[model samples]
Target: MKLKLILSILFVATCFVALGQEKSPEKGLIKISIMYPYSEGKTFNMEYYETKHMPMVASFLGANLVKYTIEKGLSSGIPNQPLPYLAIGTFYVKSLSEYQAAVAPQRDAFRADFKNYTDVTPVILVSEVVK
Candidate 1:
């Protein structure tokens, strides 16, 4: 009756308000990474870095740390070759200009922190979608 109709309307209104509140991520290049050859031996150091370092860097660059993915197997020679762990993070921006500007300071921080974990330098490569 009347009560049922009023409840339905309230539910629909509430759903709309909830959906509207979600923030849309800006269109830009998200920092995707493939941090590989993680030391299987230095389990403790690696774990610490993953937990502590990544969030600090992500916050500095005004970016969202999307996920940490463990890469495995080779496409060309999956039978023999094994892929390494690849951790992914993202920087949402209106354009590359903003993205680049944000990371410059944080880059040095990453380098310094990363030296403790592995000898190889971490490199940042950029990619733009073409369609």
Candidate 2:
């Protein structure tokens, strides 16, 4: 009985250790998040953003971009509260420098296209994915 209990404890401890282990981070990868904050009188054209804006941005990133995701905020955790953001767009690139090199020339084009989609200024964040 003691031996069985010891074995069970060992198995459980091993399982816990495995479960608690953090996932290895993706090295040398950069994540760029473009967030549009929610506010009164702000204008966001979801259709234009999804169809036109994002695709244009992706084209600029080209081979450097691994993938991209777009999210639309519905509502806050509180009841009857306003949504925190109108939309969010995130793209993962192999490196920050590569992404910058790719987008530098097209920065003006990007800014020019923004008026077609949204009135609110976007918040940009660049971060490393460290698990």
Candidate 3:
């Protein structure tokens, strides 16, 4: 009876360990970050980005967009170095194809809105989520 109880406890513990493990994100997961570099005398209106641009992006992209986050870059680690970017915006989506399809139609609208927010040309990075 003691042997049986020990085996049962071991089985339950193994199950719990497996359940607690972090599963990889779904296979098609993609993340895109648009980074606006900082320059002296340049302007980045964080208020416009949060209030106008993001809402427009959400409305334009609709279901293809899983979620998004915006970050304002404050300073570089070095005391005197200028910040590398004024702002960064990240978009999480299910797949590249889905994102492309959704944005293609609204491309013009997105471009037009950029002039309203910042003058810095954004550097874009697209990455697949692994692990």
Candidate 4:
């Protein structure tokens, strides 16, 4: 009886682990944070980023835009740092590699087109789902 119980426990544990692995959420989401710096006398660049650049990226990437936000910073208490405007784009996916394959072409096209405007480099950070 003890032997049977031990074997059953082990089998249950193994099944749980396998099921957990298959449901891993880290393979499903992405977030990109865009930092728009304080460019003196060129505020149009910000608008350009919003109107021209962003729409192109969104249409091209074809990924679900979970949330896009602008984070405004404070200047007075933040030392000498210029208060940069930020745009965050969240992407959800089924697999990381799939996400990459989907976005690569659009990224290349955006890079090429970005030369016509100011250097607006984006920092990409990704995450997955849970449960």
Which candidate gets the maximum lDDT versus the true structure?
A: 2
> Which parts of model 3 are misplaced by more than 4 Å?
1-20, 24-28
lDDT of 2 by residue, 7-40 (tens): 9999999999998885655655799999999999
Tens digits of per-residue lDDT for model 1 on 1-131?
99999999999999999988865443333445534443444222456455676656556545333333333323333555533433333333345566567667677777777666555434445664231
Candidate 4 lDDT tens digits, 38-105: 55553324466667766676664454554444444345356777655433434444455755776686
Can you give the TM-score per candidate against the true fold?
0.50, 0.78, 0.78, 0.50
Clashes of each: 0, 0, 0, 0
For candidate 4, the lDDT comes to: 0.58
Cα RMSDs, all models: 6.9, 3.1, 3.4, 8.9
- Top candidate on TM-score is 3
Reference-based lDDT, residue 61, model 2: 84
The TM-score ranking, best first, is 3, 2, 1, 4
TM-score of 3: 0.78
What range of 10 consecutive residues in model 4 has the weakest lDDT sum? 85-94
Residue 125 in model 3: lDDT:
99
lDDT of 3 by residue, 18-95 (tens): 988959654457988999999999999999999999888777666778888999999997999989999999888887
Which lDDT value does model 3 have at 113?
A: 90
Sorted on lDDT, best first, the list reads 2, 3, 4, 1
The local distance difference test score of model 1 is 0.52
